[model samples]
Structure formats: C-alpha cells, structure tokens
Target: MTIWHRSARFHYRFATNRPVAPATGVVVDLSLNIVGDFVSHGGFRNYNPDITRPTPHLIHSGHGTMAFGGRTWDVGPGDVFVFFPGLPVEYADDPQRPWRYRWIGLEGPLALPALASIGLTPSQPLGRIGDPATVDRLLAEALSGTVERAFPPTRHIAMAWQLVAAIAAKPPAVDVDTVVHQLATGDPAAPPSITAISRRHRIAPSTVYRRATATLGIAPKAYQLERRFDLAQRLLAGRTLPVRDVAAQCGFNDANYFARAFRRRYGVAPSQWRSGQI
Candidate 1:
C-alpha cells in the first residue's frame, strides 16, 4: 500500500520476504526511510477502526515531530511508537526538518501481547531506546540485504523481538545485583517463566540465567524452585493443610511430583521432613 507522499524525498522498500503467511509471530515488512522536505500531504495515516488490519505495526523515529493521536509528539532519536491492530493512527515527519525512521510490521497471536509486555500500547505508544546508537545499528542490520537474504521469517521475528527488548532494557548504570534480586523474587504469587522474565527485564534468557547463577549461585529455574520449596516448608510447618494443598500453595499442581522433588532435595519425603525425621 502506498501510504507516503509522492515527493516525500524518502527511500521506502520492503525486505526479500515481503509477504509471508499468517504465522504466529513474523515480520511482514521491514522498511527504512530518510524523510526530507516532506510534501504538504505526504504525512502517513492508517486508520483501521474496524479491526481490519491482520497485523500490528511500529515506528521508530530517528528525529522529528509528527502529529499523532490528536497531538504533536516531538519524536527525537530513539523514540519508538506502537500501532496495535485495528487502531487508527497518523504520523508524519515535520516538514520543516524531516526525519529518518524505520517501520516494522508484525503479525501473530502473540504480537499484541509481546508489545504490551514491553510496556507499549496504542494509548501509550511512545518509548525510548536505552542506547540510540545500538538501535541505529540494529536498524541498519535489519535493513541490510545480507540479513534479508540469509535469515528466514523466524529470524526476522527474533531480530524484531531483540530490537524491542533493547529499547525496553534498563539503563546501563543500573546495578546487576538489583536486577538479579528483582527477577529472582519479583512476584511470589505468580512465578514468571523464563521467557516472561526475559521479556519483563528486557534481557535475553541466557543473560537471565547467567546473572542469576553469578549472583545467587543458582540458575533461575533452580532459584525459583528453591523459593517454592522454602514456601512449601513454611506452610507444612505452620499449617495443618493437606500435602496436596501445600503443594498447590507452592505452585505445584502435582502432589506426587512435589513429594519426589522434596525427597530429592531434603533426603526424605515432605511428610518426613516436616515431622523432623530427616
């Protein structure tokens, strides 16, 4: 679809895999533009109020002001915005000083939630990359012919996910210890999966595992298990609940499996351990 002005003074094009099927999470388009001396009617507007769009899209402005959501947001370098499926929105570079930007189109069941998980939504679409240079580098890589030629749609999705993660990552000065502690014991009521933790902390799974291991002397999964075990032990010691109930409280759905794990860790069954036999 032709969305920009004819004389917008920009280079707009898609990747090799311009149109892929409806996969769970895949990039349908990856384009970069250096908008300069934008035409009067060259602004971009895509209004799909009827939930017609099959995928979500995003815009990352290198610099400029664009009218969006009934207001003019000063989009500078590293500024990013998300457009949810079926949401009507318009954006364009400031005619006075046009900007360079990148756009990505993503589709899938997980696409909307993935964006939301990183604190991006239609109402609050604005975000800033922790490192502008890094974002530029990634944009360059994504736009490069080598990546488009060598990588498949899955790779594109992974790259897009990494870009989002980088934009959401904590600033460089944040303490590693603090990060480890937060991830290790952030929400006891709802223990997070590795992918959830990675998305929430804006880091890779390997990074999460390594940091947890280095700081706590245990892997993330092990740390979580230890937390559950500790809770289970406390509940067993203080409450007269059934073993199955205690297991459920500790995030375990299977009592028999919990008993085996307890035995493995404490050298006795949960009941025996609770009765001070071990």
Candidate 2:
C-alpha cells in the first residue's frame, strides 16, 4: 500500500519542471493541443499503489510483478507492458534483483487505435518484447525529449511512435478479413489511401476493393463512417463529455468539422443531437 517515485514530469512547451507524481485519480487530459507527461527514473525501486495513468504508456523492466487491471505478472527484462489511460495499476520491484522502468506516454485520438490494431489494449497489455535493451534505449531517447535543452518536443514524440512501431507481430492479422478490418478500424478522420494499402500488402487495388466490399458489405469508407458515427451517437447519448471530447475520441480532431460532419450524418448538429433539438 506504499508508493515510491522519483518523478520528472515534463509538460508541453518542454519546461524545466520536475514535479512529483500527481495523486491517484487525478486524470491527465490528453488533448490534441499536445500537452504531455514523461516520467523516467533510473536504478532500483519498488512502487505500488493504485495509480490511474493519464496517457497510454509503454513499460519495460526487470525483476518485478506488475499488477495492472487486476492481473499480476512476474515480469523480466524481456517483458514489456502497455498501460492505457484510466486503467488501475500497481508495480513492485523485486528487492533482491531491483530494476528500472520508464513511461513514454502517447496522446492523440489515433494512439489507442494504432496500438489496438497491433493487439495492445487494456484487456491484453502484456507482451514479450524479447529485446529489453533496445526498448530501454528507445525510452532513454524519448526521455531526452523532456529536457528543455534536448531535441524538440515533436521529434521526441515521433521517437516515441518509432518505439511503438518497432514492436510488430504484432496483431492477429494475415487473413484478408483481418487486413480489411485493420483499415476499417484505423483513424477515422484520415483514412489511408486505398493505393497505400494495396502497395503495402502487395494486393491489387481492384482485388482489395472487391474483397473488402465482400467482407464488410460496404465500401471501406462507408464502413468507417458508420463505425465512427455509431460510437459518436453512444457518446453523445451519455452526455458525460462535451462535444469536443466526444469528437476527439471518435477520431475527429476538429470540433467544428465534427459538428459539420455530424449534421451531415445524423441530420443534426452534435450539440442539438445530444438533447434531441430539431
């Protein structure tokens, strides 16, 4: 029931401020405006307490058990885990063989889907990275992004993404259905070009279109639109978040555009749709 952390939280603007960990339940807002927090501490430590992480983070460490989302694991150097936002977490380093770990946080609406496309989600977070040093090295490189004197924030963030892309398998894919599913479920706002999909997977554009239509019963673009609006409706119905957050979660970064598109799809603006205003 004790928590220990040597925190150096770097917010956006790359300010030189090392604040202690925010108390549990204090949420970190992952706005598209690009605010962030990067926490990394080297050397031996044991930390365990209920912590709700703000942004999705990748963790690599040795000699400890990570208790995440009610699952406990005896993790080693080759063990890497993802901590998505809003999940409960606890970690304890083995006193005998102490370890170090880093949290390279990811933001934006696309981050979660991109990770999920590779089979990394809160429900299934642990993975065997097999090369702890490479992961640790990437973490170190990403951490430098927090220092004001280091590289620009965007470069560091891209480096963070590079680390993520390096871990491949990386999903339950290979079948035509899976590939089609990946495309349909990718970022809703900017769907990748059909040509790019064909080139990457070595499939002819026409065949991809034919199979995708057969698999989903609709064009890929239409499938994505329906999927996006389905979630938007539920979120709007809940009324828990503002239109902006709803839009962001549904892969619409611009609230204004989200409103315009909402009207086009549902025949009502998001604000009006929430309360059934004609």
**Which stretch of 10 consecutive residues in model 1 shows the poorest summed lDDT?**
30-39
True-vs-predicted CA distance for residue 121, candidate 1, Å: 0.7
Pairs with backbone N, CA or C atoms under 3 Å apart (clashes), candidate 1: none
Off by over 4 Å in 1: 1-8, 16-72, 146-150, 173-278
Model 1 per-residue lDDT tens digits across residues 1-278: 22333444554544433434347664444322111122233344334444333232333433344444575555544566555555555555644334555655554555666777777776677665655566667656765643336454455555656666776776665454666777788555346565544543457677767877988887777788788888889888975888898887887778999999999988998888778823
Give candidate 1's root-mean-square deviation (CA, Å).
Answer: 19.3
lDDT string, candidate 2, 1-278, tens digits: 11233444211122222222235654322211122232223233334343333233334433566676568866554445676665666765554445544454455456677667666777777654434456566555544544434444345445545566665423323566656776877766446556555534545778778888888899977887887888888888998899999988887878999899989877889988999832
* TM-score of candidate 1 on Cα atoms, chains taken together: 0.44
- Candidate 2's TM-score reads 0.41
